[model samples]
Target: MLIVGAGLTGLCTAVRLARAGLVPTVIDARRAGSGTTGHSSAKVSLLQGSMLQRLARHASTETVAAYIAANRSGQEWLLDLLRERDVPFDTRLAMTYAVTESGAKDVEAERQASRDAGLEIIDVGQGDLPFPVLDAIGLPDQAQIDPVATVRALVAELESFGGRVIEGIRMTGSSFTRPWMVSTTAGEVRAEHLVLATQAPVLDRSLDFARIKAYRSYVLAYPVADLLNVPQSMSLSLDDPTRSLRTASTGEGDFLLVGGNGHEVGHGGSTQARVDEIHAWASSHLPVDEPAWSWSAQDYHLTTQVPHIGAVPGTAERLFVATGYDKWGMALASAAGELISGDILGSAPAYAEALRAKGIRTADITETAAQGASVGGRLVGDRVRLAAPGSGQTPPGEGAGRVEGNPVRPTAVSTVDGRTCALSAVCTHLGGVVAWNDAERSWDCPLHGSRFAPDGTLIEGPATSDLEPVTE
Candidate 1:
């Protein structure tokens, strides 16, 4: 078996197969801990912020119950692995809060949904939060981990089970032929089973990228102060401009992590300004100092609010995919690894079967169409904007980029650190025009969420190919 991606899902599945004596080989474009896993908030809990309520919007009661079961199983499997490997993690309550009326409705709905799904959730107003909330709900005895540490531990355990891991390898796609040859930057290899654990699978056959929305959020970790009133649990706000709070301990000291201010990857304006707002909010609401480290990570959310974990529709059961965790991958991805491995080994449990057996709702179909329509609108609007008066070559200043030319072929031009370059603005995934992200100094697709560096190297993908460098 070949497992692509080295994050939580890939590593966990690799470990599972190797322990079963399958001797799976794992490959990562970067490294085992890169991608979303290393950057995650690392909360292992069933009480994901308004997640159940969101699922209940279009999912059947049985589907919701099955999702809860999947998460619980994922959580238990991960926690057990961490414990057995002697990796240190924290056990605390996980709470969701809302400050606005609409947000309170979401919180209440989530509380009721959890009850229906058989989760012992509590509504205690707001529990031990430094700031006041109109409504809040929680699940106790949840867990949190240092994501990077957890990933490293997982990789270590996988190796101990006689698994092989190769880094700096990118899997482009699989062959159209039988025996299912997998293509990668390293070379082509034949495998009986191929699993794509990458966030929003890399291949475009399923059009899975279009099924999920990509959101980017920032996190600032500040050194703990003498009088900082840190919350004892992982806390999240269900309101617009979401807020997530937790404390993490490192060798230096425990630091307060303030996270939020999420927007779709390429749609938001002034990413730096968004980062600044997160910083200001944290400084106002908590005892924080100059941040020790501040970073950003992006996650995927499905239109139906349910993760899609199964075979790629056209792969004839030879290829499998796992995605659409919607920022709750720490648990969902872990569970996915178990389920996918079980499926391959012919030992998949009831919860895995339940997730696969759930039927799509009319609302799910509508939601998918709406998401596609939003992408279509963006594509049209971007081209129209480019064709406005004075729509010709104009150089951007340092740390800036803009699109030029007509829809036949648009060029993305940028100046970063005094080096100016022009590249194709057309996203290789589906021909959508790419937008420049000022904060990250990259070209991001507003359509399916592919991202490229200033020089046009592929960063994220449903687009396996890089943007072409155009002659200026």
Candidate 2:
């Protein structure tokens, strides 16, 4: 079998299959931990902020129960793996805090949903935050970790079992026969089963992109001292422009991780300004010094709020895909690993069976329509904005990018390190007019969340090909 990603989900799935006497080849576009999993806050908890409430609203009661079961099972499996590997992790209370009245209502709703999903959460008048919180829900014994370390440990275990990991190779396309064949930049390979564990399935057969919304968020690590009074627990906000907090103990010493300020990919402007927004918030709220390092990550959110973890429809079960964790990939992906492995081994659990039972609910249909309308509106609005008279802008300076030329034949031009390049501004995956993400210096698609480098190279997302080159 061949797995086409090496993040938590892929590695977890690979480890399970390998332990069962299957020699699986895991392929990553870059080295292990080069995807979204590495950039996460690394908080693995069943008490995800308001997630149960959102799920209950969009799915059946059984489905909500199944979702909770899957996450709990995944959480347990991960703890076992950590114990076996002897990787030290911290156990902390997980809190969802609301600072505003509106946010308090969200907390109330989530509290009820948690009870329905079988979690015994307690109300806390005050969480260990430097700022005041109106109300908070605390779930004890949740855990945190350095995600990069976890990925490395998973890879080591996989290798010990004779599993092969190939890096710097992209899965461009595939063909299914007696044995499926995957085409790649490195070469062609054959496998009995193919698993697409990427953020979104590269294979477009199921139209996965249209079924979900893609978003980009930022994470900043800053040096903090005892003066900050940083909490020893994991916490997330139920407010807009969400704030998540935790700590990392590294060779450089302990640091604080502040993450939030998410926006739909390619639709928002001034990525640096978003980073600045976070910096300002942290500076005012805590004793956060200038960020030691900052990075960004992209994630997909299913309109239904339930992850898709089964075989790609119409693939005869030979082709499988797992995605839509909605920023809770650590636990959800671990769950997905066990579920997918069970399906392949012909011994799936009842929770897995419950998760797979499918009949589109009213919530799903409504969310799908809303997502479609938003995409459609963006498609029309972006084209008009790019087509307006005098829309062509000046060539961007070094370390910047801008759209030029008319909308019918727009060009994405960027200058990085004193070198300038131009490419078709239209996203290769869909016709959504690409926007310049000043932060990453990449061309990003507003409609479906595809991204490309300054020189027209694919970075991530559903687009299998790089942006087409155009005249400078």
Candidate 3:
């Protein structure tokens, strides 16, 4: 067996298969867990936002039930594995609060759907939370674990089981023969099957990229003296520009993680401003001295608020993909691993129905043009237009200057004391024009919320690589 990523999903799959007396070779472009798993705000909960309601509408009750059961069972399986291994994971019963005024209806509908699916959901007004909640739903046996620790433990276990985890090895592509051949920068890995579990599938042409939109989310971890009245909770707002909130603890102190303000992969504006907004919101709710760590993560968003798990559509026999988690990758990834494993072993999984449900098709070119026109209209009407060269007489900041070229395509020329250096205005993240974030003194991506330091180091992503420098 061969796994393309070494994150939680890849590692877990490798471990499960290895323990069953199969040797799985897991190769990651970077160190294990350094990808999405290391940065995840690992919350194990079945109360995915508005998912049950959404699923119930299109999928059958059995399909929805299987979806819920698979996730719930995956969580139980993880907890049991941890217990058996004596892994010190923090298990807490958490509640999902719908904060918007009209969220009551959504929460009620979701609770009913969950109950119909044979899942336990305690109502907000019921004895679920200790404090007052506007409208909430509680999954009885939810959990939270330190993802880094869990990954480390899993890596150790995989080593013990004689599974190979090779880091700094890139898997470029693959070919299907009798077994399977994965071509990598290092070499070719031949195995019976392949799993593409990377955050954004590098093999873009295999699946509909539009079916899964990339979204970047920010997290600010603060060191608080005490946790205060805020219990271990995870929340999602129902209003437009949805936001999520959750809290976790570290040896230093308890930290609050706020996520959201998402746009399509290359469509949001100003990463630092977004971070500042999160900081401001956090200040009002919780006391913070300084953020212990501030970072961001990106995930694939399914239009239907569910994952796409199975063989890549219109592909050969052995290639499989698991993506479109929509900010619920931790639980969904585990479920995908189990499903993929079963499929490979020639057994049908109970959750396969959910995976087989059709995804939303991409818009046609004419429709796409209309959508682009609408977005362009909004951009023009908005006050904050894209930055351009010499748009105004004043420089962008103390160290930044506006060079004459094109305002829309203005060169971001920087000076150290009084030396000149110029670079392309386009952000490499998603080609959204880059602008100077005066407050942070960094290049900001207007399209997908990636931030780069003054010298062009990636401070945040969907774009893992740094900006390319322009030369005279």
Candidate 4:
């Protein structure tokens, strides 16, 4: 067996399959867990900040119940593995709070949905939040984890089971014949079963990417002087420009992680402004110094509000896929791993069966079509704009980038840290025009979330290759 990603979903699935007497080879385009899994907030909780309420809008009560069941099983499985491996994680209350009246209504709806899903959520009207809130809800004994540590433990477990892990291997193509062949940058490898546990499946055969929309968000960690005063709960805000708070202990000292201000991958302008917004909020509310570290993360979400985990639509049960966690990947990834492995080993738990039983709804299809139309609009509009550009050679100012040239071929130019680079502005995934992300100093695709470094190195998303270098 072969897995095409080495994040939590891929590694967990690989480890489980290995324990069941199958040696799976897990490969990653980058280092293991260096993608979304590493950059995640790593809050494992059932009270997922208005998620249940949003899901109830498009799904039946039974489907929501099954979804919660699957997530519960996933959480238990992860906690057990962490305990067995001696990985240290903190148990804290996971709270969802709202400051505005509209947000309060959403939280009330979420509270009702939580009850319907059988979660023991408590209504904490105005909790220990620094600011005033209209409403607050929490589930006690939820978990917060160091994502990097969790990945390391999983890697060790997989290796102990005689599973091989290879990094820096990009999957170029695949042939789903008997003994399926996967073409990577390293070489072609054949396996009977293949699992795509990537954030977004690289393959487009099943149109899974079409069913989901990609979003990018930022996280900033600040060194805190008064850890005692900091909220002990892993908390999220149910309002626009969402605010997520959780404390962390690192080698340097304790810190507060503030995350949110999310937008579509490349549509939102001035990514730096989003970071500024976070900084402004932290400065106003938290007793923290300058940010010690900051980074951006990308995730995909289905309108149906449930992750898709099963055989690819037409792969004859040979190709498995798991994606669309909707920013709550910590436990869902584990659940996805178990479900996919169970499908292969024929011992999938009852929750896995329940999740599979949940079918797609018409609302989901309509949303998917709407997202597709938006992507189409971006492609046509961006191409037309790029076609009306000026000279392609002039270098951009430091820390800036621009797309220049004619309609037939556009060149992306960026200068960062006193260096400059030029590459094709076209995304390798589906020819979407790449836009510069001022915050991360990278080119991002507006179509399917593919992102690239300043020199055009493929960072993540469904793109299979780096942006081509532009010749004079």
Assess each prediction's global lDDT (C-alpha) against the native.
0.84, 0.86, 0.66, 0.88
* Model 1 steric clash pairs: none
lDDT per residue (tens digit) for residues 173-248 in model 3? 6664446677787877787677877765656545434444556667778765666555455666544545566677
lDDT of 1 by residue, 134-187 (tens): 999898999989888888888888889889889998888787656878889998
Q: For residues 211-256, could you state the per-residue lDDT of candidate 2 as single tens digits? A: 8888899999988766236877789899987888998888787888
What TM-score does prediction 2 earn?
0.96
**TM-score per model over all chains:** 0.96, 0.96, 0.79, 0.97
lDDT of 4 by residue, 254-304 (tens): 989999999999998999999999999998987776898999999998766
Question: Which regions of candidate 2 deviate over 4 angstroms?
Answer: 176-178, 387-393
Which one is best on lDDT? 4
| Residue 355 local lDDT, model 1 | 74
Pairs of residues at least 3 apart in sequence or in different chains that clash in candidate 3: 266-447, 267-447, 268-447, 388-407, 389-407
lDDT of candidate model 4 versus the reference? 0.88
Best by TM-score: 4
- Residue 155, candidate 2: how far off, in angstroms? 0.5
Clashes of 1: 0
